[model samples]
Target: MAQERDVNPWVKMGLELGPVIAFFIGYNRWKDDVFTIAGTDYNGFVLVTAAFIPLMVASTLILWRLSGHLSRMQILTLVLVLVFGGLTVWLNDETFFKMKPTIIYAMFAAILGFGLMRGQSYMAALMGQVMPMQPEGWMILTRRMTWFFAALAVANEAIWRLMSTDAWVNFKTFGLPLALFAFFMLQGGLVRRFGLDNGKG
Candidate 1:
């Protein structure tokens, strides 16, 4: 297997986040436009979703090409983007796109839950390369992450179902990422205590 290169953090962040930011920009720029296809009218949301899909695909491919590897989460996220984004465009319904995040989070939660049942920390398996820690720490963090993903799934469902599309877009773009950042920041103590070598890089 080819060894993966250590990607620059800024470049990595850009590749991961560029598509999402583009989607937001595209949606806002053309949200008032109407697209007609096959004698059917599609809203700007659908149009932006179609555009978003390709951006996601391109970003994922570029990330893999640069880093020489794709994490399981990245692969899964790309697959879901293609599947749900394609469905949204094909069916001209935004519901599929809206539900994509929920499904992704829920699936991750389920996978982690299964790992926990088997006395394994799939969270560590997924993240161990960057954050080396004791086995006990991995297990504890894994348990918390499983619940966190579940909560995120629930939050996505609630936001999409009860809020406006604009609101949902904002939540997906900003709220979700912020929540994740906060969650990880809160884990600083765990990263300190159970971290190998006292969390030294």
Candidate 2:
């Protein structure tokens, strides 16, 4: 097993969220710059999408260097960002970038849901080493997360498709994080009720 490095919670949060924040800043700063790439006229959204890809890669690398390991979810997220972000920049179309979050959420939901169907708890498999829990707790958490991720996917689709670019960007930058914080807060009761003593279950 890889040695687990102790990371400050604030630092972890910063590493995870910094790239998106950077993208938002970069977009707002260059939204009107008449930039052209690959024979396509680029707008704020396209430029931000382009910037996001490299920032995500650099962030993931920093995370791995600091923690000595990258979680599966992190790896999956970076891959999707690169692929979808690349498409968005290359095509100079914002649709691909807008769909990235929905794709990611749906993929996670599907993975967990499939594991549950197979009588396995992927939540435990992914996080169990760090957070040991009873089988029941893992099952409950996995089921909850599967549904939560599905809901997020639907929400992302609705927002990007129905809202303007600025609204969609705001949702991505602020709304998603708030929603996740609320979701985790709501899970506190379940965690307390099911958490094992001695950090092992």
Candidate 3:
């Protein structure tokens, strides 16, 4: 089994990011095209959801092959995508797909919150290898992340309900990822402050 470190980070990123990119492209390309099946008309969102499910499955498989295994969070995400995406296509309703992100974010927030209640940091369990830190740091970061995820869940719910489909697609494809990146960037000070090597000198 190849160690995760042996794999390029960019390749891992592509595996995760490719499906979202394809969903965005697929929706835009077919947004105006309607598919009629069994006397039901389906829109671009349904079309993209149908295509995205297989793409997600393929990407998850590739990531597992490269990393040797998938984390619990990764597995959860794949399952949710399949479940929600399938519902969207099968029922010919876009609401299921729209609710998927809110469900995912809420679940993560709940998971982290449960861990925190038990005095454990599930975030550390998931991210410790990538960011070694003191237990104190992990706890603090986890607490913040739990709340952050909750906020994201609320934001996603608001966005999809209040905005147009195109706007939601853009937010999901670009805005959400960028927001997460910015959130991590903002935590640089915390990372340095409670890093495991802080007092080694």
Return the clash pairs for model 3, or none. Answer: none
Q: What is the C-alpha RMSD of each candidate to the true structure, in Å?
A: 1.9, 2.2, 1.8
Ranking by lDDT: 1, 3, 2
Worst 10 residues of 2 by lDDT: 192-201
TM-score of each: 0.95, 0.91, 0.93
Candidate closest to the true structure, highest TM-score: 1
Model 2 Cα RMSD, 1 decimal = 2.2
Q: Output candidate 1 Cα RMSD.
A: 1.9
Clashing pairs in 1: none
Q: Which candidate tops lDDT? A: 1
- Candidate 3 C-alpha lDDT tens digits along 48-127: 89989999999999888877878887898899999999999988889989998899999989999999999999988888
Model 2 spans > 4 angstroms off: 37-39, 198-201
lDDT of 1: 0.93
Separate clash counts for every candidate: 0, 0, 0
Which ten-residue region of model 1 has the weakest summed lDDT?
192-201
